[model samples]
Target: MGASSSIPTDPNQRVQVIAAGYGRTGTVSTALALERLLKGPVLHGGSQLLVRDDKYCKLWLDAYKAKDAGDKKKTLKLVKEATAGFVATADVPPVDFIPELMELYPEAKVVLVRRDPEKWWKSVVALTSKATPWWLDVAMAPIPGWRYIPAFMRRFSKSFLGLAGVSDDKASPAELIERGGPFLLVAHNRRVRSVVPKRQLLEMELREGWKPLCQFLGVRVPKDPFPRANDAKAVDEHAARIFTRVLQVWVGIFSTTAVVVYTGWWLWRNKQQSLIRAWKSLKTMDVRKAFGNVWKSIRLIDLRKSFGRVWNFFKPANIKKSLGAVPKAVWPESKKPVVEHSTGYSSIWLE
Candidate 1:
């Protein structure tokens, strides 16, 4: 079994919901729903979505230029309180907040929303992470070659989820689903059941079709299906279209720049050797593994290879290594080498 619940058991206090499921599992939508359903203040992810709103963008931009290095905390607090109009969204680096947030919001509803893992992965790569936010876009612009892609992915994926209007992006609880239909939802429900008595913990859709949800909360159901939350796929398609346009232009420019850079470097070396060797280290197992990944991306698969992932309160270090992501155990305090561009290149370019 997973270690003890990190959530408080209070049935009456402010519910703490983590919405820990992967992105695009409908976290923003749930935040929107909570803002209305909770009928009170909500403080959601702040630093992460500065680009999503003019107020936040301006605040951070000013802070970045300000001489007062200590103004960040005050500014963050102001930003949090400023958005008190609706369900507040405040997503930030997950690991950084886990310890303090859990302590700050005791009795908070810990809603770990989940969805089909494959869908989650694909949605991340396709729809959400494409923003190439200032964090990733500006920062990664200088990185060279293969070393750049990983940081580029994380900064975009974890940073501001670039979207137009804020709806589900503001307040919907985590979504739970299985490939078969609500698998993660069922599993999450089961996990919660293992700890809290079923009565206190309700598992109803945050929509009108689900009668019990409002009943459980002592609110009357609306005449409509919980306001037809507009988290529809069309929103994704629209934003994706804009991103696709910018991408084409940027890709062309970058490709040209790269060709020029490598060609000149090759001539300067006076030898025909490559800087990095060929990509021949690819393993047969990796090729075989990619077939499943391809199938999963197309929604053609729903099989589970293991349940061992559930046994730890925290996902184990060994599993992370197996997954090939930068493991949390060693992720922080690591730095990539910086390449110093020579003055010769500038002089050559000017000439």
Candidate 2:
């Protein structure tokens, strides 16, 4: 199908632009561009829409039937109405659902941001160990959240379909990125060229900032430079955070279990195995934290403020809403339950 074919006849009709590049494809830059150039609100990986905006997600979930791993537009009519109504929200980068997006938003504008393949490949390769939570590390498996386990398996299938030049499954510190990169870049190129004007999808780098992107998207340039790709070595920093959070959770749970058993006294020794198992479970990402980056990356949320959302979910205080017994935030002076968790996940590492 063609670009005009999927979109409404009105040239001015609101367009849903899916920046379909996998991770490290200048998605952040693209988000900044769309916000500045199109006078559009960048959903930042659809985080705001998917998590914060209850109505948007509900309609999206209901419309698309919220398939975990398959067609994204099962509810196309619902999508068009919901998305158009809240033009403020952006679609998540459903990497696998590109075809559906193309068909669903025929008039959708697609931007394929890519860099030199060899360079991109190297960057992706470097990121193999840098983006995943360390709990997944063989050495770290003693801890749980890092593993993402089978329950979270569908998640990996959803937002991130291995972007390196390799398979997406069980990526080693090295080979994990070999299968997904080039193919993803190629797929994106084909999709955008087939739909939006090739000219519309410029090779705009984040370092160069808003001017080139703004002009292409028909918006005025911003006074400030757009955020660059890989600032502070983002992938590495992210991976570190994953590892750190995993460590915190793992240690937190084991320590909690130990103290509880000792203080309660008379705990059976055989129960130690169960406690250890529970500790491992806690070591996994604090429910909110586990999906935090995924949500941010999928929806491109500016995470500066998302910690509160994550913390709320992880460190819920409200008894009315909690499951797994409300977590008590372990602070230097006190452990206290402080928030409500509505995110449909939980972990022992949380206070």
Candidate 3:
């Protein structure tokens, strides 16, 4: 998705470009570039469908359902309504609906960004992760509004990959990518070529630069270079930022809850008759005295033991087990062991 400030606020804005390319094919860069050229935000699927508005996922879900039920009119209408205010649509679920989108917006120019099949598959493998990690859900659970993202990703993954005839509900995005991803990429580009008329379609690559794209769209090229975004390093940095924020929120919640529970227990243990009096007494207490009381109540030995337990939970062996570092139970006893995870963290610790 484009930055919040870049997204159009007006629901009346109509889509002028339809990106029929699969994701990790410069769709994010295309969305950013289109924002500059078209002077309005473009909808990038996957993250956009869940991150921006809470209702978008539901709308797209309904649209997918309508399409599955052979209700083309309803599907088009839902997609139209869902994408209102965007100047263009790009990436996954939207890529899957190119035919319907072309039917919905006849004037919208389609841009199919192509990548080398082998390179695209490698990128996809590197970029994708499990649909949702257990830690992510646990961290986001307290924030009711943000809790919908994981669920949306899971649903969207199944539906989007279904276009490639992948119906494995339990498979991770990485797993799905390992299974015929190169074929899917080639077939999808071929399908786009067939579905879109030559007059309406502009097939180019990320390395081709802005000239072709600008000429095709009939828009003047910007003075600045084209946007470069969603690359592997950028993606890693973005994920790191999100994880940092989640960790901060989780720590704040845990600390606040612990303090509140301790305070309540202190009040109950003291046999305080009136809640009002207890609060007044707490408020009037000396800062040093209060700190001392809280410290004494917490019991240093117990706190230290709790920290030790947490440390042990995140120990190398435990972390590995939590992340599925061990081989599968289904593997035959005769077969050599296979470790499917990345080795990036190996430099930091040994297991």
Candidate 4:
């Protein structure tokens, strides 16, 4: 027999029900039913790791490692921490830790939800038909919680399959579901029966519904019909919503990134071409001559100032008056008109 439960019998145990069944066996519907009957929250599959606090992932991961290491005390402690607040549990990672949970909460009742093995396998295949696309991985890689999905899957799978001593190092949880055959169902049910005491255990199918469940838990049959949550159609719809959301986010991100990168590249290329053209034009010029021209332009400012003063003093009219006053012998030359150029310079021509 597995080590006996060490927990002191608590009249007010936090967890009242534990569903130690593989998923796709009406686990979702069972969870919903239990919530209504027990009047408390049930930790179902997706919420176990997907939606709840990210810290739960670490807690569960630690517990898994502890369990693998054969540290029962530590494993029990971490499992309790991981599953603290919920009144009942169902499906996947939570169901995977049945032995630990039974030990920790001896008062909690175990309900094994079963389906025909062939039908269960078919349901699993339909649910996990689409493997995560490569682009989806690339897109979700930057998301902190999402990036750890693969690692989490591997670890969780190893621990879960370990329960049956079923060695599967090659296949993923999805692949395992597809190829695992009927033996998986058989082995899991056998193990649960072997471990849990008959008095504390209740095995029920989806078809059996409220009658057995209510009688086992000593709760009144709810006026409402037993929940039929997460059927194949509902699973497909949920998958569609997730796919659409992921596709939309990645599309927007990829489109914006492509536009920004192209714009930056275009600007850089044009600027580079301009610089290259400038450099080539400079290479064709005489450096000394270019420097001399620039220097001359600087010197021209001072020369223009001096010339302005001289021009004001020696106006054309003043020059003509001075020439008339001078004798013909002194003037002895042909005179030409003063030409003013557009560049603010005046030329006096004499022949």
* The best candidate in terms of lDDT: 3
lDDT of 1 by residue, 1-351 (tens): 001112213323343344333235555555544545665443444223322345443443343223124554554444333332422232332311332333334434444444565655555444433444444444334323212333323432222222211222222111111112223334433544455434444444333243654565566766644433333353455446445655676688889999999999979775443332223345324887788788788675333323344544246675665465321222224444333334234322210
Q: Kindly list the per-residue Cα lDDT of model 2 for residues 1-351, writing each as its tens digit.
A: 000001123333455666655545665556555655555444453233312334443554454335533455464555555445222222243444455555666655555566666666566556544444443545344443323232232243332344333334443443335334555555545655665555435554555666665665566777766655443254445446555866787788789999998866656665787899899998874888877867778777657678877777776464345664544443455656445443556644434
Residue pairs clashing in model 4 are none
If scored against the real structure, what TM-score would every candidate get?
0.36, 0.50, 0.68, 0.72
What are the lDDT figures for the candidates, one per model? Answer: 0.40, 0.50, 0.74, 0.70
lDDT of 3 at 148: 59
Instruction: Name the regions of candidate 2 deviating beyond 4 angstroms.
Output: 1-16, 38-40, 46-92, 137-184, 195-208, 229-232, 267-351
Candidate 3 lDDT score at position 166: 75
Candidate 3 vs candidate 4: the lDDT winner is 3
What TM-score does prediction 4 earn? Answer: 0.72
Q: Which parts of model 1 are misplaced by more than 4 Å? A: 1-20, 41-99, 133-136, 139-212, 215-218, 227-351
Worst 10 residues of 1 by lDDT: 171-180
* Tens-digit per-residue lDDT, 93-184, candidate 4: 77778888888889899999888988876765655554344455565555444455555656655654665577665446665654466567
**lDDT: worst 10-residue window of model 4:** 1-10
In candidate 3, position 226 carries an lDDT of 83
